[model samples]
Target: MSVVDVSGATTSRVAPFLQGLAREPIVWLIVLIFAVGALTSEYYLTALNLENLMRNVAVIGLLSLGMTVVLLTGRIDLSVAALMIFAVVVGVIVMTEIGPMLGGRWLVRGNTYAGPIIPVILVALATGTMVGAVNGIGIAYFKVPSFIMTLVSLTALRGFNYVLTNGHPYYLKAPLYGWIGDSKVAGIPVSFLIFLLVLLGLIAFVNGTVRGGRFYAIGGNEKAALYAGIKAQRYVVLAYVISGFCAAVAGIVFTARLKSVDAPLAAGYELTAIAIAVIGGTALAGGVGSPWRTLLGSVAFAAGLNLLAIWGIGNWYQNLAIGIVLIASVGLSRTSRKKTHS
Candidate 1:
């Protein structure tokens, strides 16, 4: 009787844990990939490589967080990469113009500003927010499909970025501007730390708040959410605004890290963001995902790319691998949804 009781207690505790793990197999997949990498490469498990990998994925990870939210709402934003480029370009230009008026030197061989960091950051974030508002308005008020609306924004914004810079890259001369990307806090990159904070905040918002639950409700069943008296359009618009703000933040960090911004910077990143979110186990049909899983997906993506680089794979093959992974993820999501419904 004692043995049976002990066995029953163990089963009761472990069954739910196993079921949770089964529900998110991607987590296990990530673990497996890391194990393989550690075993295969002498440098893969080193602290330096790990840090570099985190830094490399931080921007995409930020974008993925926003993408996850949008996906949760049964929508998508294809203009995030272009918005990032536009924000960086506009921010840098505004800072350059303001720095001279503020009595700062024209540093870096006459092409960069030495001050106005705060104002520039604000301008960039505001620009992204405004663009997001437009996207939201068009979709919510005008009843436009999110895919088409953002697709048009993507094209127009990319063109605007090119027109603003005339196809040339803008370099920031201020060390302070680059510090966010270059500096470390307690042996961790500042950019990664920022990413970590954003991730945590978003997790709190989505999992711990009623407002976040509404987003899921809307995505899961729009008619039901509307019947429940939730303002579906407002929440959808808010999601886009959040996505735009995130893209702007990513742009600033990316520019600081690279010390330069180009009109074409982060091209194709929207697709990559979507891929990361979907691969993280977010349902493409919407209403099922977590930011924590998206973070793991981003890390897995960065790791795969790093491994490819180490093995001397070309960019084309990298893209191919990403496509395959995306297809598989979407298929799995669809299957899971069907099973749940059945």
Candidate 2:
């Protein structure tokens, strides 16, 4: 065959494969959510309930986005929860600085501007980036396995958490901060809106961006990518950074919901994120899934939790449910399911 003909055939073959791979998960999952939600509960079909549910998943959803990247690299980061706790401490401290506490020990409603929100947001993002870099550096440069490196950070981060807050619960003193957690715009919760936007942007990036394409390449075959001169270390660092940022964002959502902070916050969140990632159809072996699917897994799992909570299920049972999901999710690991991995 002529060179031109060969090139055209290759392009045609590759284009359709990418397009089909991208389209199926999103289309099927959206339809499935509505279909199932509509059947199970009256709350599921309502606009308000779904909005709250989405808001509920937003923080974890955000974290799972980063987990998706980490898992994509065929590596895992176990310290995201610690960083999240750290970010909440920073965010609460920033909130106090923005407005004085009304009762010395308590914050009365209808009070001060919760700080610009941007500063806290930046702090969260920055903290996440730094934490991720630490994980990436340990794994990529020091030759540590990602699991061990992140586990070490997990211990250190938990320590930093207590030090940051001085072992006290921190509460925001500003009323404006309330907007981030509970306020609605145009009849929809802003927190949920932000989560949706972030989700959509991530979906597009995974499907279209050059850097994102490299993520899939690295996840699919890191050795091949290295041989092809792809900057593997750079992408590894970027993945951890993204995961860290996700943890920070998740803390924002979480603290906003409670309007309080604990040094031990998100102590088990990293596992939940990983579980969501796995249940979302992302394999533990890496390179076979996307964010939206991870998100769908999150929604299905989260909604089930909420339903359980509403049914008056005890916290003990709730723990058991989560454990089941985690165990089942790990079944999707390449070690167990060879066909799924392929």
Candidate 3:
């Protein structure tokens, strides 16, 4: 081949490949992080640690799934962690109150009720949905900025959680709840499996459903979506509802795993979830990103934490490491967007 022909062909093949890498830089970042972990620690690549990592990331991963959808619509849900806590609190309270009515006794073994698990799960989900609906209505119809709306909800819901629990944690002795939170299937944790199922469901909804695209449209340009006959408000509201539902599910799973529910159960998890979503290449500006990316982000975050622990890092340094990761992820996201647009 002529020199010019060879050069042109190489450019043609390599340019698209480079572009693809730029579009999803987090994938490379995750690979790099994993490589570093594997090189630095003998235990990092062990199956037990990997399983523990998956179990650890499950709640945050589930929260990030909902947050990704909300961010896709150019909104935020600061109340998600609080909502999760509140949902679990409500579920525990209901179980405590209703166990006797259902001819079930409070199990002294774990200081938990031996009540029907279904009712507790339903109530937790419903609580999250209702709270989410209120957040949606305020932001979508009332024209409240999502940041402020969800901030208000964060405070209110957290207060409610405290009030509901009387500043104490409730132990759940229900075997079924424990199973949902702690059990394993085919060598995988149930919580992780639930997170994976939610991740898949979200991926399908966002990529395959009309309503899912509507969220992107609304985030991409609300005024334009509205002009195009899309009920932008409703979809925005739906996004919050989804977030709330995810929070509720996370709450239940977390409670089951810990075998207890506390007022501050998931405090500050909202920030971690947001960081995961943003790190996963989900655009903070909206109209871009996917569940798959968020999943990668969640895994990366978990891996980083595991590495820190293995290195004998203290909790203080661990948090600092997360902050650094968050900043780096945001910088990478901005750089990628610039490259794509330019």
Candidate 4:
């Protein structure tokens, strides 16, 4: 074969590989980070640390899932972390104040309510959904901007967290909570297991259902979707409701893991959650992204944090690192969009 023919063949072979990498930039980034982390520290790649990392990041993973859903609808939710704190606190307060009235006993010889754990979960989820509904109503019905509405919710929910807890923390000793938060199955953390189950459900919802498709359609072009008879406004509200429910789920996981509820718990988690979603290749402009991508993003983010801690990095530097990653991801997303359009 001539030299020109060989060059063409080589290009044909490499082009597909390059395109694959482009399609999953987050996966490559994850591999790179993992390689660096493993090389940098002997402890970074250990099983114990990896397990703890998964467990600890589960709350953020849940939040990121919710953020992904909202972002898919071409909107932002800034209240997830605050809502998380508020929801768990509300759950704790209810179980404490009302458990006795309903003949619920303290199960673990401490503050843990042996009363139906189901009610506590329900109450927390209800609180989150209520707040999310308010946000959705304001944005979808009153034509309020999503950012502003969620921002208001963020403030209110944070205040409610403090008020409900009276600026204190409650330590829970519930058996089921401990099992969900800390127990392991075949050496894997239960919290991480919960996160994985949620991820699977979300994947099916977004990829397998008509309603899920509507979310993407609405996000892609609200006016166009409306014209297509998609009921864009109602879907927007549904997106916020899902976001709220996810936050509440995260709160439940949080309380279980720590066996405690506090006003300040998960403070600033919203920023990290958004960062994770974007890093997973979810476009901030909407109409693009997936739960699978967000899953990769969450793993990458948690790995980064684990590496930073292994290196004895300070908290301030960690925040700086997250900021840098977020900006880079956003830039990459924009570039990819431009390339696609081109």
- Report, for every candidate in turn, its global Cα lDDT versus the true structure: 0.86, 0.77, 0.86, 0.86
Across 153-235, the per-residue lDDT of candidate 1 in tens digits comes to 99999999999888878777666777888888898989999899989999999889999988899889999999999999899
Poorly placed runs, candidate 3 (over 4 Å): 1-23, 102-111
TM-score of 3: 0.89
Alpha-carbon runs more than 4 Å astray in model 4: 1-23, 103-116
List, residue by residue over 35-91, the lDDT tens digit for candidate 2. Answer: 766676677667777777778788788888889989988899888888887876765
Give the Å shift of residue 108 in candidate 2.
Answer: 12
Model 4 Cα shift for residue 264 (angstroms) = 1.1
| Residue lDDT tens for model 3, 56-164 | 7899998998899999999999999999989878876777777778777754555455666788899999999999999999999999999999999999998998887
Which regions of candidate 2 are displaced past 4 Å?
Answer: 1-48, 91-116, 333-337, 340-342
Error of 1 at 190 (Å): 0.9
Record all residue pairs in model 4 with backbone atoms less than 3 Å apart, i.e. clashing: none
Per-residue lDDT of model 4, residues 98-139, tens digit only: 867877654345544555567788999998888788888889
Alpha-carbon deviation at 289 in model 4, angstroms:
0.4
Q: Tell how far residue 279 is off in model 4, in angstroms.
A: 0.6
